[model samples]
Target: MADEVSDAGTVRADAWIWSVRLTKTRSQAASACRAGHVRVNGERVKPAHAVKAGDEIRVFHAGRERVVVVSKIVRKRVGPPVAATCFVDNTPPPPPREFVAPVAVRDRGTGRPTKRDRREMERLQGLGGDGPTAR
Candidate 1:
């Protein structure tokens, strides 16, 4: 039935995510849920999990976590303006890029790196020496 599909009061987690533009596509939202990248109220949920207003949702994507509190339920994808009002974003700002050290660059015509140069570069990358310790 139409009411069964739309639910009127609640929406599927993946549908809600895509409808609100949290992800680029509905399929991506479903994939995220299946990969354990989505959680509702601190519990991991599948794509079909019901999402309602006031529920807190956390989505991990693109190396960042997006925390949002649902304020509205929508089943159909909407424009950005409308999507913006569906959730209250609670995610912290990403860390500054300046904190990352610059990578070593070789000049043109420098040819291949010698063993010593490679070792030095590896050390600069913190992947040299003994490497990571075993668990």
Candidate 2:
């Protein structure tokens, strides 16, 4: 409803993020802000920071960074469709899975990796041949 939108023209950073579904919960948004994972206009912001329309916000969450421009101000959590209208997402697309290098996973109960295993893993990770003794 129209009443759900903030008439004050600004809302708390965490509340806006949560209302727009940028984060799963308001607490998560607040935690991210407290941890220096949220920014407004390129400066780190606290959870209580006031966010107005047109402000640029960057949030690091769930292993990815999200960049969005505030488009509308909503004080209460809204549906996904409504939330989508609240911000203009400018995040870059994620890299393709094929572009990601495979991580070396050692089996459990293997204790520690042997020297050769370490070397091999390093080689697979493209970190080989350039060590203190390589010369």
Candidate 3:
């Protein structure tokens, strides 16, 4: 029976991370998976591991991580169409994000710039020619 096929694994953790447009590529997803940062249903798993609808997952990225539940899957790399099928966020509610104004970094004088550096700086500043008005 067609139903006999396992409909399990709504999404592979790596594929989900990859298709959701998280990591740039599937290999990166696998690497991330091997790093042991991803957890399914509260347990660590590998990249090829699969997740099914209602399965929960946790992913740590950058400085912060998120937890989510699998809602659906798109085996192929997906665009915005299947976006909704991917999953649901279930991370523990976080406190208000703290925003700290950055202090402008000043590079100490490392001697005068070479001719190329000066030209590049001039172009960057748009001193060479007319460009879009600086916001």
The candidate with the higher TM-score, 1 or 3, is 1
Which is superior by lDDT, 1 or 2?
2
Give Cα-based local distance difference scores for all models.
0.85, 0.92, 0.68
TM-score of each: 0.79, 0.86, 0.60
Per-residue lDDT for 1-135 in model 1, tens only? 233223238889999998888899899999999999999999999999999989999999878899999887887887788778778999999889998876978889999998777777777787765545411
lDDT of 3: 0.68
Give the poorly placed runs of model 3, Cα more than 4 Å off.
1-11, 92-107, 110-135
lDDT of 3 by residue, 2-84 (tens): 22123364556798777766567888778878999888888889998977777777887665687777766556676654654
Candidate No. with top TM-score: 2
lDDT of 3 at 52: 76
Model 2, position 21: C-alpha lDDT score: 93
Give the poorly placed runs of model 1, Cα more than 4 Å off.
Answer: 1-8, 104-111, 127-135
Give the lDDT of residue 85 in candidate 3.
51
